[model samples]
Target chain A: MTMPSVSDSGLATDAAEGSVVLERVTRAFQGRRVLNEISLHIAAGEFVALLGMSGSGKSTLLRALAGLDEEVEGEGLIRVPTARSVLFQDSRLLPWESVLDNITLGLDGPDPAQAGRQALASVGLAGRESAWPGQLSGGEQQRVALARSLVRRPQLLLADEPFGALDALTRLKMHALLRALVGRLRPTVILVTHDVDEALALASRVLVLGNGRIADDFRLDLDHPRHSDDPRLVGYRQRLLITLGVTESA
Target chain B: MSAEGSTLGGRITSSTPRTAQASSRPGGTRLVPRRLTPLGRLLGPLVLLALWELAAQTGLLSPKLLAAPSTALITGYDMLANGTLLPHWLASAWRAWWGLGIGVAAAVLLALASGLTRIGEASIDSLVQIKRAIPTLALIPLAILWLGIGETMKIALIAGSVFVPVYINTHAAIKGIDIRHVELARTLGLGKAVFIRRIVLPGALPGFFTGLRLSVTSCWASLVVLEQINTTQGIGYLMNRARDYGQTEIIVVGLVIYMVLGLASDAAVRAIERSTLRYRKVIGS
Candidate 1:
């Protein structure tokens, strides 16, 4: 089968070589350019992490990928236009909805309730179909978000540090959960994160961004659900540290 | 603070003993435990009553001139017994209910209309905010001139006064919906109705209920003012008539009844809101 192409909103796709090819995408807010000139290409089913310091254009890149913010002036080619979903860093659960309803916010299809339940089950929240997002812990809300994106089974997934705010242990577990989901679902995911280990743990391809450009694209050949400190990944982590220009912060 | 805490703890721990003692009394008590929050609310009222009764006993306040808690309670009961109080209270409640209901319904409809479209929102927001700022009490003169001194005019005035709150709250509620949620709905192809029903209304509900409670309070307050017109009944009419008869106790009694009604209506709406949005606390969303 040909490699899938993901949409701008992180839906799965069948676009072969350059599913997302940004030549020189730039975004400026009130004459201050947030993204100066970002050119990158994301392949199909690629778990690519955009890692950078705060305000280093990683989220700006992800936003451009998600099509959430089109305020930037740029040249970009994004395949698979629809069937996409974005998991915000905030979890953004509908306050009034049950976990299942939050996963499927509004179903515009044949049977949304059933689909929503299935989505809930996909993220290991099977028994919490009737549970409200408020009742759930912070971890559980993020899991609902994971389920939402999983439900779409899109060509791409845009996650802006989806587990950035989680506790150390929860974030570790969520990393595993996300890796498992991406492997099984195979949606081309673009995660904007600041954690180098997280990038190594969750993503197959880690793109370190700085000064509004892809500074380095590190490919980790390790399989899904890898440990945080895998031996082969250790060297890659060191390389990422160098790429991000962090002086012994690791 | 320590004493208060200890007293609270004592109440919690001695509940069984108290209930058992009550059961053994000459008139056996049917004891039902109440939650602390509600019990806590009653403490202030009870303290005020105790102070009033003490003042009356010391003759610092004349029971005839300024009825104490006990005297007022008796007077209130007397009015209740002679069938004068119930009708007046009930009539005021009825008019206030209609005014609040009609006002809130209109507000919700207008909010939905305005919130869904920029043109509707823009056209109304400027004028509505301006009109809202103009005290509804000031409009009583104009309302009377236009609608005449009748029950119709009273209800209309009350409704008009309350509408601004409900409208503003509803509109704000609609505005508070997360833009991401709206985008999610659009991506899913949910039409206007489904989007409004599932996302917009629920998102706006908390604010809407807050506005609604405020509106009901205003409506009831306005009902008192509105009924100052050619009405033979209602709490306002009761107070006005008492003033004419030089019955200071009855006038005080009527005003107290209005206050109680306002408190009760607000409490009821709060209870409704708690049940409706219980899931918010549940999911931590």
Candidate 2:
């Protein structure tokens, strides 16, 4: 199935150097192709959301880009900068280490603690360096994870259903924090999620993957901190839902 | 899942949620304070002692078979006064201590090699399995022949007894490390030394502690058989002497010392567990 291409209205494509470029990337597992002949160019500072059904190769593509899944069959040229970081569904904090130590983990600097503190403060966890990961709530642990990722100041950030485990209210609040942080950092980001609203709420450009390829690309030129109730997001939401093969009723 | 969850600090999206709780201080790894002891624990031992005393006083139990608590206490005091118990107690303690030291060292080294390296595991694991099957006390005859029924034979017996438990526990602990944590180390590009220091050692500590407790008990248990290896020193020697004279009170005294030593070592391990594993308690009740 193929999606009809929409006009790229108000989408700025001038003088933006590509930070990540994928050329004919294909991945297969035991004779079954998951991602096939995928190609894309993500400019610096652009936030892209990858929307797809389960097993549609969204995560496989993401992992391939991270240089983790190198078993691709074809000449798939994936160019990612040295400065990059990834966040998973769970916070994945080292339970043994304190909050601050987790942030400064693997980070080399004259004063990693100070840098971790600043990162924690940015995530609204100013004095929580000494607390264990188990002490914090789920959301707070994710915040520490965010601080750990941002502590390195990576140029590219990849997220895979980070808020899939969070509640609606927490998810909304996290959206705001993420938008604020991204606006400040100006790094290119590729967010992979099954949640269409999340993509519409965050991504400047949303790509829908189907049959191991990008089925549709929707460019939302909305302002920052877009709400779920905004009329501008309604059309994109409907299109995404239909593309994801969700029926109105069973 | 956000890219921030990646240990490698790879590509991530900034669109994830941030409703994380920043303040619940639940699972801190601070030193945990000891809780109050329940009365039930002391009650059991006291009741057992009282039952023995009652039976002895009523003559329902013969003194030859089992000495009364009062008789044992009086014998212990008399031996203490005459300085007969001190030398035996000292010798037993020394043997147990050295056996534990040597066994623990060898076990840890072998466990580390077996746990971390395939070659080490392949070479040492089968041999250890064979050693584990044979009770260390069964080697008494061989040990006596090799080391001449002196301090060497007794110490070797205790060491051999402790080795298997220590090795099994330590090796199992090392192998039982969570795969995710190892992935985290690799993603972080941690060096071998740093990985061993930061991940391997701390991860295997609880297992090692468990093994240490077992080693202590086994070492003490073996000391009984070891000191009997034609030795004229230690509590075992004292027991043999009492046996020759048929002085059951002195024998009872020696038995009580061994019991106390076993309990003391067990308590020491518990204390270490409480301090080192305090982090596990930090989770909200």
Top model number, lDDT: 2
Local error of candidate 1 at B193, Å? 3.5
Candidate 2 lDDT, A35-139, residue by residue in tens? 777888888888999999999999988777655553344335567766677777888787777889888877788998899999999999998889988889889
Could you list the chain B TM-scores for each candidate? 0.81, 0.83
Give the local distance difference test score of model 1: 0.77
lDDT of 1 at B284: 21
Instruction: Give the per-residue Cα lDDT of candidate 1 at B227.
Output: 66
Candidate 1 clash total?
A: 24
Off by more than 4 A, model 2 = A1-18, A70-75, B1-37, B145-148, B282-285
Number of the predicted model whose DockQ against the real structure is largest = 1
